[model samples]
Target: MVIKGGILLAIRYNSHRYTRDIDFSTNQMLGDINKDEIANRLNKSMAIMGESL
Candidate 1:
């Protein structure tokens, strides 16, 4: 996921005020993912939050 906006900038440098949510984006095409692969990748992503792949 590609983080952007105020949340991303705040994470980079601590902010006195910030939003309560995180915003992210991906270059993935959901239509191309198969069911089995989708389950596998979802679990993998959940296991590795905040870590670069």
Candidate 2:
């Protein structure tokens, strides 16, 4: 999923309950970041953790 900017994902720091889907929080990226690329990266990262898309 596409993560919008100016949000915070609180689960990273303290241990919090999480949902099945990942919640993202990112500051606005000034440069170019392809959506497909992000999806691919996320998919690869999830694969490493034995998670499926």
Candidate 3:
């Protein structure tokens, strides 16, 4: 997780809000990580959450 490496924030808005993109915020340590890492980590998180499904 980026937060593990020092990402300090995160924000996500619903697509139903009429926005074209989800809004995100972070004090992410980009040099230490990148978009793919964030996405993959989030996906893995979702997989864990979805195990209940």
Candidate 4:
């Protein structure tokens, strides 16, 4: 996955831009993506951070 848009620019250059969203991309096709697995992983991560979706 690649991070794009304002979030990337802010992190890469330490810019002062304010961004409210994160953008991601993958080389895999949409049909090949596993939605449940992704959701599970994200849930686990959020749990580790004491948060939830």
Q: What local lDDT does model 4 show for residue 39? A: 77
lDDT of 1 at 21: 73
Name the weakest run of 10 consecutive residues (lDDT summed) in model 1: 15-24
Cα lDDT computed for each candidate against the true fold: 0.69, 0.56, 0.53, 0.79
lDDT: the better of candidates 1 and 4: 4
Over 4 Å off, model 3: 1-23, 29-33
CA RMSD of all predictions? 5.3, 6.2, 7.5, 4.3
Give TM per candidate.
0.43, 0.49, 0.42, 0.54
Candidate 3, residues 1-53: lDDT per residue as tens digits? 22321222222332233423344556656687677877898899869868966
Question: lDDT score of model 2?
Answer: 0.56
Candidate 2, residues 1-53, lDDT tens digits: the string is 35432222433344354455555655657365587888899888768757531
lDDT winner between candidates 3 and 4:
4
In model 3, what is the error at residue 49, expressed in angstroms? Answer: 0.3
Worst 10 residues of 2 by lDDT: 4-13
Best by TM-score: 4
Candidate 4 per-residue lDDT over residues 15-43, each given as its tens digit: 88849787889999989999899879868
Checking candidate 1 for backbone clashes, the offending pairs are: none
Q: Let me know the TM-score candidate 1 reaches against the reference structure.
A: 0.43
What candidate 1 gets wrong by more than 4 Å, as runs, is: 31-53
* Per-residue lDDT of 43 in model 4: 80
Residue 53, model 2: lDDT of 19
